[model samples]
Target: GGGTGMIGDPGGKTAERVLLDAETVARNAEAIATQASTLFAGADFTLLNNADWLSQLNMIEFLREVGKHFTVNVLLQRDFIKDRVKDPEHGISYTEFSYALLQAYDYLHLHREYGCDLQIGGSDQWGNIVSGVDFIRRKTGNTVHAFTWPLLTDKAGKKFGKSESGAIWLDPAKTSPFAFYQFWLNAEDESLGEYLLKMTMLSKTEIGAALELHKRDPKERHGQQLLAREATTLVHGAEEAAKAEQVSQVLFGEGTLEGLDADALQMLKAGAPSREIQTGTGIVDALVVARLASSKREARQFLADESVLLNGDPITDPSETLGSDDFYNGLALLKRGKRNICVLILK
Candidate 1:
């Protein structure tokens, strides 16, 4: 299990962090741990809380034993620390200043307890990692290694998170698997190659072939599809990834009513605008009730123009009625034009 060391990090961030309550931190730790367990299910892993050990250490003892290995000159040389020290108004706090040392101590604790030698993190942690490596060598005279992966970003160099709803969470409750899948499915063409190799477990040969396939038919999105499925499965389960793909096809790709399970229906119902209508409601009235149209006149006009569809089938008849028979398992899907979608619940 990897420890949640970066949760409170203020490094490279230009502002002070809003502190989270202990209960909130615990809940978030549990959620992040659950996601990690799913992502690395096959491996022997444990989820560690930095507060568990870090909180137990006496400040004086830490400064005496661990802190003595590094000098002030070296500590002040880290880019983020230098920037913070130089800033006048947005100056770093003692808590923020010692964060690197605390992280370095976390590495030493883990190494001593579990023989975990290799410390892997984002590129921003290079300075902190070196501190840990040096500390371990001074204390135990043993060699340790550190590896940092490049930070993932879009072509615009903006962090690859923050969807319309903000940070893309691993918790399905926070960011539904359907939206997560759509995020990858809509990857930009220029960043597709980098995302394919970095974010997925796809083989090099398979990626090479897919890149060529994507080039030949970029509109088909062969590479994006593969990356989407692989990445989604790696985080969420295979069953969820499949359902997400199916939901995509049914909603935006091709239209369908078949193979929709209860979970899939729940996702669709939660995502689309919906209302419950009586059994005898006319289609035009239902349309207005569902906000597919502003008025009966507009609803009728939509029908006349052949722009209204019920369950993906266009309804040209203005006099059509919806009853129990028109409902699929008590839910009816409505579409106006090609994009406006609504779900109607039959009561």
Candidate 2:
């Protein structure tokens, strides 16, 4: 089944959401369905609109069936509602207050139509799932099961699947497959063992073997690579995963500028820290602009040490002005010391 795209559930102490426009909700629903199809290929699925039934219900009928079962005292006592309502900065809204009832009615509708018995969600959703179950029991005298997986977190106690940039989105346009792979590949050594087994559908024995290899040589990043490959392949498909790996190797490994085209070069450049240099600016000025070195003095020091690369060639002359010819077919490669490389595409 597809997601309901609910506007704002009264489950958290957050600001009232700007409800999505009809067109925006439609687009989001389509994207969600596409992602779900990838994860659950060949499975029977139904995309239902809660508004279909919800809008049709009159006040009297809703009060008689669903609303009668819920008590104001009990609803007010719910931790989520209490906390949200108590918060001065982000007080709850009336629309949000009725969110639980709408969700419960959704469950009742689905159960009556499809005979759906189980609901699964993240640990944070336990309260909502149980509320649905309670509504079904009260209305139809039927028992329903609900299950939740504990929310995953990293070793540092931060939420999983998020980075400094933002959420690791499933859409390739939002987040490239290369970036997705790199995220998993760079997972911490401490959490690698448990994360590999839990996050992906890899067999337990395979996971154990990968863990053993990881312990044997942590620097090799065996487990991390596997996690990246498996997860990326699952989400973006095998072919895209292979390309992502290739791009990663060329950028991070011994592979150099010759292997990358203009597009690939641009993608690689995006991964590195970068700065802009105006046309005809000198290499020293470019270095200063990039903040690769603190000042002109340090820029000179780096140049003297043969630490700067212009289009993959070391320039000993600090005074050398960057010309159109210095660019690699159209892009200028900038490097500080040797480990960090960025590309400057002429705009």
Candidate 3:
């Protein structure tokens, strides 16, 4: 249920990554536990650190015990090792070559301490998992079971958890719930059926209904809606999901700024693309900086035509400087006329 020494699993023929600093790894471990708390709330889970035992092993003792079982010939036969060592651009490093032994020791230590009978990981981890099982059997005379799920992939065979923007991070600060929802909402039709079944805990009947609806009318976006709702609720909870849904409805639907609370309005603006301004900047300067208008002359013309809105209301004066009062709950809502909106959060 948890990872030990995350020397960063080698997969997809990737170059060896710089190992995490002790402090950074500690922080990452804590953060992962926090995120998992919501999903595995009632499950029996234990977070462990391999360094607890790994750091204590003397070099002579380690070689006599754990290292004796592994041979260089067998090690080089691993797909990751063979591919990386052969690749001209990214030859495998010695530290990465030793990764398997380190990982196997983690399993051995866990078995000795907790009597952990099973290890599970992605299908790609079969070699590593088997290595751990074999090490345990050879050293301790105990049988252990290991299972791995097939790597979750889309119809095109690309991994499911990434997007054009980047990895879909579990941290809200890294990727907002709205953006996260949008990512799933935009899943290709071909992938929706498999994705819903694999990723969500929804029952078979509910998943089947969503899939049927998607097939009947793709434009109705039943799959997208269900994906967004379930994912958002899982990550941010029902309350935050409801708030994000309301915001999306107002921004993309027929609703206006009047429908939003001050805090919600501020969040909306923060989510949008924006530019910051000094305290003394005039409305004209702010408009130009935000690119709502192309030039100062165009900005003035727009202002004169009553085509500029601050917080969704028309502004008639070009000379008006952005004042503290213009900000709704500490965020300035800017719009060219009433349609194109940008939010400015005062620093």
Output the TM-score of candidate 1: 0.89
- Candidate 2 TM-score versus the reference: 0.80
Q: lDDT rank, highest first?
A: 1, 2, 3
Deviating ranges (above 4 Å) for candidate 1: 1-7, 161-165
Most lDDT-accurate candidate: 1
Q: What's each prediction's TM-score?
A: 0.89, 0.80, 0.76
Worst 10 residues of 1 by lDDT: 1-10
Q: Candidate 2 lDDT, tens digit per residue, 116-141? A: 89888888778778889999998889
lDDT of 3 by residue, 1-347 (tens): 12344466665546778677777877876777788786677788876656667777787987788889989999889877888888999898766777677778888888889988888888888888888899999998999978998877767787755443356877888888777776777788888877787767899999999898888999878897787778788887777666676666554444555667865665576567777766567888888988898899989998998878776567878888988777545566677853576676676
Better of 1 and 3 by TM-score: 1
Error of 2 at 64 (Å): 1.7
Candidate 1 lDDT, 142-242, residue by residue in tens: 88999998878888887654333346767888778888888899899999899989988988998999999999999899888888898888878899899
Identify the leading candidate in terms of TM-score: 1
Candidate 1, RMSD to the unseen true structure:
2.7
Worst ten-residue run, lDDT, model 3?
1-10
| Residue pairs with backbone atoms closer than 3 Å in model 1 (clashes) | 1-45, 1-46
